[model samples]
Target: MTASARPWVLALGLLTALRLVAAMMLPPAPDEAYYWIWGRALALSYYDHPPMVALWTAAGSGLLGDTALGLRLLGPLSVAVASVLLARAGNALFPASGAGYWAAALLNGTLLFSAGSVLMTPDTPLLVFWCAALWAWVQAHLRQDGRWWLVFGVLAGCALLSKYTAAFLGLGVLIWMIAAPRARHWFRDWRLWAGGILAVVVFSPVLVWNAQHDWVSLVKQGGRAGSVGTGSALRYLGELIGGQIGLATPIIFVLCVAGIAVACRRFWRGDAAAGLLAAATIPAALVFLWQSTGSRVQGNWPAILYPSACLAAAGYLSPRWHRWRRWGISVGLVLTAMVLLQAALAPLPLPRRSDPTLARLGGWQDFANRVEELRLERGASFVAAEEYGLASELALHLPRGTPVIALGDRWDLFNLPEPPPGGRGLLIRSTRRGEAEPLWPQSEPAGEVSRRREGIEAERYRIYNVTVIGDGPRKVALPSRR
Candidate 1:
């Protein structure tokens, strides 16, 4: 390793170590628990997403057991790898000005990455493989070697397995090739076609799984494309912009916007490297931008763009805007630190409703234990929840091998075992929502519990002792055993 790269290595190592410690200290978010259940029940694909996250979670938890650190073991480690790959890509693309180090630093400084690194999600693996693919693409260009195409194909395939958003990477590559005169000749390369085939091969299991399940996963995700109408377009657009700004942290967001603008200008000026980065960014960004007009665009959906965009931003800001770059990193790091502290300690006195950290992570373990106590008191055969997240959280905290069934249509599509008919269950639902009357034939309010953190109530749940009738309202044929 070069002398200059050593400091970055040490810095990233320290950050990753801190993240791992935080992972152990922090509670698992509801979605993390939900995905943990996915890890327990391995599948080629799931109702909501591909199986990569499940695989990642399973591997981690298998090694560490089902603790928070176990569930999140790979997340920080993957980000560390991603940072190195991104830095290498930046260095190869822009040799001078230490743009590589800046790219890695800026990425780690982002709230989206720094704070998110402690929680395991589909985005974790998605970001890692996405950066790996970008690095492979850079190597392919630098070496003019067909073998790198195969590596790119594998990485891209892994990215696709991680999330459907990675399809944009392929689209970005196509756009880059078409727009760059020098890259156009690669159209005749047989290896390029082979690489495309390889990606499809790697992703084929998901396709087969979807086919077996009547295309449920594809149809469910594809349904997000429909427009909700222009009446709320401006509202959703503003939210999308605001969400990105907050998640990216304001100054880093501004830097990314400026960098993208610079990259676009350079693309027109025949800078293929700049074109590559811009192409990787713009297509996905435009889709999200347009989607915001018709529907709610999730803040994390744009995460895939950051790997290449951060590199571009680093190249654009280095030397000329060094002061601004430092300021952006400082602000992002500060914001990230605050978020991490909040998630770990809940020291801030923000209202439970206003603090997402409290809303998502706080009191779940205690709440689960309370529900378990109620289940025993009521002699219930199983504990059930109307919400999937609640169900998964309960599963994570309840006694090992306890039955925690999620009562909803989405659960019918999962490979999970169905709740036994004619058995009594403790049904938990949000107090704010009306009762699910049709779900229980004989029902009586058993108890209530409040999910609280730091003396503030995040939410309240009403529990009912209900005798299940037949298969209940949300039932379907039990999914075939895998």
Candidate 2:
């Protein structure tokens, strides 16, 4: 209601509106659609990530229905949460200051936060939970209020439930405690122990699910960060740093790294406020930095660091680099605007082999329409896709309750029951980077589906009529899909 709060209000409103429009106008990314389908049948955990994203999506679609707007509702909603929490976090880190405002600005201006506001990925909820926990941690440490510890525990657990990467949040807290001499009492504090117990309890469902499934999720996610390759360590590290730069706008990204270094120094000098910010980011950032040595890390893998990175950058970046801040904001806003337009209109003409965003946007509508026609014309009993992403995309768009299945390991994410043995299907293969051979031996290419963008061919899919010869029903209909 105050004048100062107006900027935050405006930022939140503009972001929410842009994200909502983008979410509705642009089709869901294949991964976003996969998450939405995952939401349809909510589970404690999933093959990909934990159940928090499922919970977030289910809440949105359950109330608003299965439309894109409904599926992506929570993403925009979280923007408001992230905005307010980052503000509070900024104030907590530096009392009676503009740190909060700058933090919120630095965060909202970047594609990391803007694109995430509509994408509905695990990072969506994880961002919300991470910022919330950071705020609570600052309050608990600064006020020495034991009650805030419980809040931190709950938020931390929720972050874990959102993604396994949040384990670094726990590590950060421990590092902060050990590194900060005065904070040693937390080790013996009963409130801390109670909070720890609460976090374990909150995260128990994921543990139970993994236990039932032979700990597959743990092994898979853990194995990703498993072995460190001695070769290409520098190259991987260089990419990780460059990727973070792109994720955060270039100038802001540089400031974020420097801010973290500054905060780490303050932590060593016994600054609790700086320590809270450093603890939230430094440990997680380092883990991913180390991860880059072993694997080809994605550009956004270190997105978890942005909450604290934004806050730290705000407090540190604003003191200097006024012109650089303008450049960063301009670049971020321009890039975001271009993306929104791309999502809405697919105006960009980039190579499909390189940047696939616009290409992904173009082909789906045509693919969906053609696939439906194939089902009716060819009398195909089921829709089979070569990859999990294709299966989910076709499944989500083709029919309300169509029997769409992925050929290989992609089937694990779906909650649908196994088919009743024998069936005939139309196999849709997007020849971008997949194998030419069909998973079923009894299948051959029947025809092709060409999807175009701006009157130019963007994707070519080979359609195959596949049959599983068996004693079951040779003429079975597709399952009544949900």
Candidate 3:
């Protein structure tokens, strides 16, 4: 191997191994368990996200065992893959002053990647391939190699299969092809056409799934960034800013903003590489900014931009800005260290209001154990949870070979076949915003139980005895999310 490649390769390998250990130690987040459910019922895709997370979870579970560690093994490893890809992409684009290491280090320090690594959500798969696409673009465009175009096509398509946010990659590609004289020729190139076709082929499964399901998934996701009613827009924007600032950290965020400004200037000055990176990232970030003005946007909605944004930042963060760069890296490292220590040792004790991680991931195992006892004592043949997140947690933490089904949403479409139809099952409904109000109005309330963490009620479930209808027990229609 080349001298330069060795350090990166070694660092990445060690980081991957350490992250894998953390993945094994930490409890599965609610979303992780929910996706685990998707993995077991493997489909082309799902109602919420594409099939990539499900595919990863299924592979990890198969390779390991059906445990928390097994289900989440890929989550942290994906971070390492993304970091390595970011390093390579940075080198390909900036190619100065160890840009590769700086870019990877900067990205790793971002909470978006660090916390995301253990979460095992849709973002993990999206990030790994997003970096791949970024590197391939740099290789294909900046290096003037046609072969990497095909690789970019595959990775970009895979990014889409991971989440719909990848459409922004296409938008950037379109803008670059239109705005950059050097990129314009690609419109007539056979390689470009071939790459486009390949992307469509890779994404065909999602399209086919939508066709079969009346395009429900597409419609649901498409409408998400619309208006957030009237007064909620400012509140939503504030939340979005706070979330992004937290995830990226203030120093790195400032660097990214400055980098984008510098890239815009350089692109107008006929710098093709700068234009490529800016066009590929800026539009996606702006979309989130604009969406935040109208609707509540998730913090990670624009994460696809970071892979290129980090490299863009590396382009201008040079010896001239050494003090600023050092400060950013130093503060970022401290933040990262604190987060890693918390994950590795234990979460800090805080009030339930301030401790979402504790309130959510902490009490689930105990909650499952108590509910299992309730099922046995009440002679309930099966267990059911009101939401996919709750259902997935119960299914994962409950006794092995047990079935915990989701009671609402399109869950009727994927609920596990545990006690079969007509069986008397114990339904677990939380007291969230009066959730138990209309729960099983037709059935009798058999008993109730509480799940607590540090003497605070993390979750409370009212158990009801209900016969599984032929179609499954009736549940109130879940409110439309979008």
What lDDT does the true structure give each of the candidates?
0.84, 0.77, 0.75
In model 3, the clashing pairs are none
Consecutive 10-residue window with the lowest summed lDDT within model 2:
472-481
* lDDT value, residue 399 of candidate 3: 83
- Candidate 1, residue 402: the lDDT equals 62
Instruction: Give the distance in Å from residue 428's predicted Cα in candidate 1 to where it truly belongs.
Output: 0.7
lDDT of 3: 0.75
Q: Which tens-of-lDDT digit does each residue in 198-269 have in candidate 2?
A: 888899999999998888999998898866666698888898887777778787788788788888787778
lDDT of 2 at 140: 83
TM-score of 3: 0.92
- Evaluation by lDDT, superior candidate among 1 and 3: 1
lDDT score, candidate 3, position 307 = 73
The C-alpha TM-scores of every prediction are 0.95, 0.93, 0.92
Local distance difference test, candidate 1:
0.84
Q: Pick the candidate with the highest TM-score.
A: 1
- Best-to-worst lDDT order: 1, 2, 3
Candidate 2: regions farther than 4 A off: 228-231, 433-436, 469-482
